[model samples]
Target: MKCVKTQDAVGHVLCHDITQIIKDVKKGTAFRKGHIVTEEDIPVLLSLGKDNLYIWEKTEGILHENEAAEYLRDICMNENMIQSEVKEGKIELIAEIDGLLKIDVDKLRAVNSLGEMMIATRHTNTTVKKGDKLVGTRIIPLLIEQEKMEKAKEVAGDRPILSLIPFKKKKVGIVTTGNEVFYGRIKDTFGPVVAEKVKEFGADVIGQTIVNDDIEKITKAVEEFIEQGADMVLCTGGMSVDPDDKTPGAIKNTGARIVSYGAPVLPGAMMLLAYYEKDGRELPIVGLPGCVMYAKRTVFDLVLPRLMADDMVTSDDLAGLGLGGLCLSCDICTFPNCGFGKGV
Candidate 1:
């Protein structure tokens, strides 16, 4: 201990070795394993470089370096733990990973919890194809005691899905119909929404044409988009059974196979899906109804992700959305997190 002479009333301040203070922070014994600590521990822990401590002061649980690292490792290997990040000595993670990505994320939680000095990949989703690579892990210096960061080293191994294989993005053609908007009677809003939606999947709108309610004209427009290299054609408006509604007929005249004439999706229930194939080359076309105009989230919200992933949307995919597709006109729509993955 060293004496301090700074304070006027105090003759000397005792200086002490702070190594034990650091050791206490390194081990949860500083507080209880799950016990919270008071502010008094702060000055003491700071005396020895414990900046990386996880402090759950409210729960009386303070996880230091090693324990915190172990908790993270546990999170990776334990499917039931949920996907959470350790912050301030508390583990905060998602309760589930439903449709988080193209690959099943539950596979990431299948490894055994073991702190290793090296690295290894425990789960590859088993179905890895020729070009699939599952995990990539590494180590970095955390500047604490060598033992404290050991658990962090184990987590360094990747929780990555199957290796990234490049596939040509789906090419889309957008056909905007409606005589009123075509002749400048009203503004064109569907095209922008459709364009923005497709762009999120890295798909390009190669060709866009505005045509009247004539079936033949709209049919020609669809053929022209195909000639311009469209793998998918999205026709907006004229989906209902009205006399002026010609988009469905135009799509039928193109000789494309109609996958589903009508879906159980509200607002967009009148939507249509068709496909045309010649010599093994197939083109998928979707006819969105006018209700897709202002409806925030509908069946379109459910299908877009699968479409972007280039996964074929069967009637089954359409069926799943029916239960979750009901659009509740919320006063404050939180999209994405709110059932509809529409925010994407």
Candidate 2:
């Protein structure tokens, strides 16, 4: 790119966008890239503090800002995502469907460290709606070395940095395990809470059973739900260390492979995760702790979206969540958006 006086230039094409900022009124592009300078446009450009403008001057080994931005976009695109037109040397990726946003943070950081370009994305593994902006890519300068962009592409490798996992509608079975609720000593609140949480992801609660803390009864309830076409089963309560808590044993009794029996997260440390398989089809069976009924957000909130997206939860995955597992319990809960269990 070559710099030319804004007043002297009359026909030179702009190499980059000219931005205008007016206190609280406006802050956007006033002259877009490729806009040919004119006598009338000179005053407007000058008003935006553009005493000299960078006009198009192609260099063999260098790429213009817009071209470099495209390389960044290509490195981050994936299914169920749409790219916006390049504006002011930047492009944004928008979700095409309401789903969970997954970011390859290792790859993202590597790309960003390559220099001269950047890809900024929202928090990974968060829920996003259709048309929500998920990522933005840009070149740091009006012109950049093509070699730098090539290195970024290499760092990104075969996999894109961003993807949207659409939430699949699954038939859920809820097993509320508590002697108090089953014996009519207390009103059942856990069942309703689990059902509402599942509904938020558009999954259907096909059936629900209230079982006593007895391990045999809990095991039977879980098996019955799977037999009744439940793709996933959630057993609430009875997951603590107390002798009366037997939900974890009940889940294991179903012949499900237990992924984890406890988590590092507060308010959910007693959580249990297992996968029961029948006829080659694996079904997830979750043993939720009492915190689900009291805490606004817990490890359940962290793993439910992944389960809804058909992503398996492993012990290693749970182990990696310790860094951000403690919830602040703010006056106004902004879960999923908050850093409760996003360490991995």
lDDT of 1 by residue, 1-344 (tens): 22222222122111222244334455333333332334555565555454434322212332343345443444334232233343223333231322213332333333223323222332221112322223323222121233434344344355532222222477889999989878989889998888887776668888788988889989998888888888788999888998989999999999998878787766578878877885686678889987777877666656665555455667755655566566676888776546442221
What is the C-alpha local distance difference test score of each model? 0.57, 0.88
Off by over 4 Å in 2: 3-54
Model 2 steric clash pairs:
none
- Kindly list the per-residue Cα lDDT of model 2 for residues 1-344, writing each as its tens digit: 68888887788779767788999899988888866689999888887888998888767988878778898998999999998998666999999998989899999999988777788899887888999999988888777898888888898999898989999999999999887898999999888999999999999999889988789999999999999999899998888888889998989998999999999998799999999998898899999988999889988999999899887778988998899999999999977677888685
Best candidate, TM-score? 2
* CA RMSD of each candidate after superposition: 12.6, 3.5
lDDT of model 1 at residue 108? 35
